[model samples]
Target: MSFRLYWPLIVLLLVIPVIILVWQWRRRGRNVVMPFDHGQEGTGFWLRLLLNSAASLPALVLAVVILILSGPTRLKEPEVKRKLTNIEFCVDVSGSMTATMGEGDRYDASMQAIDEFLEARQGDAFGLTFFGNSVMHWVPITTDASAIRQSPPFMRPGRLPSQSFGGTEIGRALLACRKRLIDTESGDRMILLVSDGMSADLGGGRDIEVANKLKGDNIIVYAIHISTGEVPDAIINITSLTGGEAFAAGDVEGLKSIFASIDGMQQAEMERTAADAVDYYQPFAIVGLSLVGLSLVCSLGLRYTPW
Candidate 1:
């Protein structure tokens, strides 16, 4: 709780004394409350008492007014939203990924397919990586829904990161994905490797090292095999190595359905929500008012009574 206004400029005005009557200061009581004198007191005696109490009335009212003017407040927190999965789109940015297989080339169609998948999820964070000769992070593990919705169109042959001069380094792509996709502790963590079956060099025996590291993490790798050409043995082993599933993207419909299943992990209906709570400060003003009111009532009624 807090006070909205600490400075009481208007409070000073409350001290202006109310002139009840020209004779108010001069009033003197003739009656004495002796044991035998009570019966002789007149009605005017009670009237004097009421009139005297009136001196403190304005101050009491002023105090309540000040309290109302000062604002007091308190705070509230919001509930957490639904979270489902941490997904990574391991796009084959290799030179072959630009080969035209469907209406657009593999890369363009793959990006569009990823966009569709992202649309269905409410509670998922996704990352993008393009691997050809080297792996590049287009985006990192993020819940940036808008950015995910709008991926840059698949690169034209000339625009891609690097040329695919080397053999398919399938193991390298998987290694890169293994590193990115495993850290999101809860829900489902996965890597969807989309590529024309080609393996880039998975540097030496690091495949077993990475597989051993990811053994206990609930990470799954899904293979998106583009049926546009002959797939290599290394591309096929990605899902096998990680104990996950594989899908063939021979047609646009299959491509759509395959990615849809990946995105469905982010359903998160029970875990989705947005809320904001704020605090206010009004009680301090009231406390100040009560204090000032009590002081006035005591000062007025006790000293000025005329019974």
Candidate 2:
């Protein structure tokens, strides 16, 4: 560690010794010599040294006080800290997700992949949202991943053609997810959109509007579509507008690979941030104060007789 002074002008203290010498020389020149003696004239060298030290204690204390006023400090290196990214899983629970995409229905396969993703990314904050005709936030954005991992079992595919829970309203769902992320107001924001059907709600320029909103909030959307047909243009546009991409996964393995790809992408986003420096002047201040107090105590009884 390196030490520095805020008020380096305190270096003027180096002239104090010369000033004392000059003052003593002038005083001796003006004084008339008189033969004087004390019994201590035969004092030993050690006693004479002790007397000199006692007389010089005030100067030592003054030097320490000047050093303290200079604001002596030790410098610390800047540190890098890792920041958590906030990821909200926006899953479709409409009846269409019950359609078979692999060994199990699309909903079940997606949930499994999501669970694996959560396990792999333990350091990030995660939120869960299940959307059919309406959007439900199963878990708020939190660093605790267990809430998101345990959420899939409670959410099931709803019957289709119903206004309550069967239709795909991607627009509204996107908005809902965006609101949750905005409320968090921290970290790198992301939305993992898992769906297997085309949405009627994204028909009339709604996707563009929602994408702009997500972009405005610095939210990136990564869509994973588990479908036999091509992924919808709306999904692509929404993801691309926010600097994210849409993935088409036909099988369970493909789904896993997609999640892994996303995990890789997020890892690249982790960056080093500079941290504040720590102050290390307290101990020096304490020592300086203690020296001043000791000098006061020494002056009470320690002195030398002039001979």
Name the top TM-score candidate: 2
Looking at model 1, residue 121 earns an lDDT score of 67
lDDT tens readout by residue for model 1, 1-307: 4445664544453343333333454566565554564476346656566655654555455555654555444445556666567888877666666677578887677878888777776567888877767677778888886765565554344476454522356567667777776666666677778877545353465555555555556667777887755544444454556676677777777788887765554345445345443434345455656656666676654554445
Candidate 2 lDDT over residue span 1-307, tens digit each: 2335533456676357446544533443222234576533343558545655666656665666666555556546565555778999999998888888677899989999999998888878899999988898999998897887777668778543457668888888999999999987668999999998898888788899999999999999999988878999999999999989999999999999999999988772445556444556677678767767776777777654444
TM-scores, one per candidate? 0.57, 0.68
Which structure among the candidates has the greatest lDDT?
Answer: 2
| 10 residues in a row with least lDDT, candidate 1 | 13-22
lDDT for model 1? 0.63
Instruction: Please count the clashing residue pairs in each candidate, in the order shown.
Output: 20, 0
How far is 37's C-alpha from truth in model 1 (Å)? Answer: 18
